[model samples]
Target: MSNKRRRSIFEIFEEYFENLEKWTERFREALIEKPSWDHRACTMEPLSNIMVTPTEVIVTSDLPYAEENTIHVKPVSEDTIEILAKMKRKIRLDDFGITHYKGGFQTLRCQIRIPVSVDIDKMEVRFKRGIFEIRLPRKQERDI
Candidate 1:
């Protein structure tokens, strides 16, 4: 007999949902071409990325000139987290020669959705060299 492993139906279902969630996130991002800066809020959406590993989901963002003490990462829901940080100095659009938009900003804000189940209580955060990192341990699955 050929040696091959078979997956259980529950495993298959779990995989399907995980893939669907990931695809949904990708599709939403691809469909929405939002500006990086919000003039009314005076906030900039910094560059961010998410990575899922077998043990944890890690999210990282680039927040240059951000004041470390003013950074906050809070879980707004089971699968959503909000990140906000205030910069040390205001950034004027005119400084970049954008005369049409006259505004100064000094904050960075972003909301992220975790693709997999994670233990938010055990989440860890670190900011260094203008890079912010968040690590949330994956919740252990209990067998049915």
Candidate 2:
């Protein structure tokens, strides 16, 4: 018969707590937002999702009124990317029943932080149906 010892109760509880801490950190990163000077004048936060895989990280953003040609994506840092999208038409605060802000905005901006190192030069991006997707390949150990 093979000899394999089962984990003790304390070991199980320790593993559980470790996993909980990891999950909490991931959740916090996903929900964190970077404040911008123009945020107060912005009307909407386009929903976004970041998916991390062994080989690459994919970031997708929903920009309802944005034009495909005006979308721009660039790496702000080794672990951060910036997105700028221009709407086809201006969006006024008055449209949302706020009269205090007189000027209209025609752009949407967002910044996303990736958890791992990525090769910015090899990144791929796509924009279709007012949605933008960015694929960033993880840097290899040798590249670092």
Top candidate by lDDT: 1
Deviation in Å, model 1, residue 126 alpha carbon: 1.1
- Give one digit per residue, the lDDT tens place, for model 1 in 92-144: 89989999977889999999999999988899999988999999999998879
Candidate 1: deviation at residue 58, Å? 0.6
Model 2 poorest ten-residue lDDT run: 34-43
Per-residue lDDT value at 120 in model 1: 87
**Candidate 2 C-alpha error for residue 26, in Å:** 16
Superposed on all Cα atoms, the candidates' RMSDs to the truth, in angstroms, are: 9.2, 7.5
Which predicted model would earn the best TM-score? Answer: 1
Where in model 2 is the C-alpha error above 4 Å?
1-44, 100-103, 142-144
- The local lDDT score (0 to 100) that residue 50 gets in candidate 1 is 100
Report the error of model 1 at residue 140, Å: 0.7
